[model samples]
Target: MGTATKAILTVLLAFLIFGAAYASSGLSIKSELKAVTIKYSLEGTPYIDYVGLQLPEIEDQISGISQDTTKILLSRFYATGLLYNASKANENGYFTWSGELKMRVRVGQMTTDVNVPTTINLYGEYDADGFLRSGRGNLTTCIITISLYPPYTIGLSNPINYSFDLNSQTVNLGEITQLTGIVSLFATTTALIVALTKDKDLTLISET
Candidate 1:
């Protein structure tokens, strides 16, 4: 092979080996859900409340066996309305109420690292006085959905899905909280490694 051709081949081989090494490893999504918050309020019903908010899922960790391979990852938290029930109490009109919940998960590495925007899916019932029976009613529960590596990307075949219910009062909030913490922990650990490996021309996590 010509000198220039040989050089190109060598670089190509190095990249292939690097890519294989990186794919075998994985990144971690820390659980830092402590940043999420939920609040509610109501009108004349005195029994209802309004609540809404969206939280972002940050990085946790990136792992690699070789110095040339790194993985691009995306992740987020979400909530979906599974079911709800409400009843009327000492009032002339019946009351209708339903709830929704949030869940969290990480989207593994992708060929493209573009951030995916989060979406909220809502499905529930509202029962209040006729004055405002239907007017952008407050969301009793918010179903959160997120995608990774957007704009023409579909390899994993299945995106993460989380269903949450907040009306029961004994719902599984821990699952989401735990996942968030894990993602956060991973991000912090990876950051520390990067800070320490700065002296070397090599990156601690490879993006091969």
Candidate 2:
């Protein structure tokens, strides 16, 4: 083949390899509600008190490769019951609250609906003078399992997991820049090899 034709072919081959690597190195995510439990107790004489559970807003970050840009995946936070035991208080009694939080989880470019289970336990006490004695309030328990799906195999590495308290506002899993860089390097290397081979072939043909 002519020198120009050979150069064009080499460039095309490199781009094709790069495109394939880019497409195959995508990332995905999956999340599930593991468990939740809340317990509370009241001390001293019978008295009325209310308990409520509040979860922080959930968000995931999507970082851009070429540009300094970031995209946030905001989850629609919905809880089955936020307020519990409004009318009467369990006098010197312990209580346990459990329920589910429904949210839309986003993995890469795809989004899926998932239900996260939650539970909380608390204890409270009052003094003889009708004042608060010794007790714990605003207690919460939430366990969520986050699964990360990388385009490449993780091998022995464990998937990302997050555990948050009721007071927690945000939990950032991590970023996927390392994998993107690796794929880019592979594409560039493959393109260089193709160009080098073409150069060798052209030199041999001219000598013959």
Candidate 3:
């Protein structure tokens, strides 16, 4: 055989081996909850509060042996409504509140930012003679959905979902001081791999 022909065949063999290695391996992912904040209005004045919680740190790996996805859910409480006059029975009140979930993702060497907004709806009823009625208030909940895509992978899109119940039973103003401790935890882990073979060098391969 000619020297050039033998050289070409050897190069092709090497690429096949490398490609097989990549095909056997796969992708990985990691995630964590960074922070949570709540804001509300009471008597025409706005109030903001931050929940005290420990955050998890994350790192990415090149090896294919890692979790495929990570998800976190952060919940906060907001004051929906307040009784202006306790003397009037059967009075109704309404208030608006909001919170947020912030996330950071690391895909290989690239990091992306994601923010999800949350809102709360609250309603309350008063009793006769302006006294606030027990079990007359209601609170609304929130949910978040996140979808992640790799750089060059095919037939693979990771989706993460979270739900939060911010009802009156779940949150309260006087008890807020006690709820300041860490209540929940979240985490995500991931790994990445880029296939590079001499035979495939002529054709550009995207990074994931």
Candidate 2 vs 3: which has more lDDT:
2
* Candidate 2 off by > 4 Å: 9-175
TM-score of 2: 0.26
- Model 3 misplaced stretches (Cα beyond 4 Å): 1-71, 75-96, 99-101, 121-149, 152-208
What ranges in model 1 sit over 4 Å off?
1-47, 50-169, 202-208
**Candidate 2, lDDT over the whole model:** 0.36
* Higher-lDDT candidate of 1 and 2: 2
Give TM per candidate.
0.20, 0.26, 0.20
Worst 10-residue lDDT window, candidate 3: 184-193
lDDT for every model?
Answer: 0.30, 0.36, 0.33
Q: Write the per-residue lDDT of candidate 2 for residues 85-190, one digit (tens) a residue.
A: 2222224444345555555555677666655554534343322222122334432323333556565221222221222121111111112333554576577777
Scanning candidate 2 in windows of ten residues, the lowest lDDT window is 68-77
lDDT of 1 by residue, 1-208 (tens): 3457545655664564444434323332222222211222222222222222112222232122121111111112121211211231112322233332222333554333332333333333323211111122233222233454455333222232222222312223445544555565565555545544452333333433
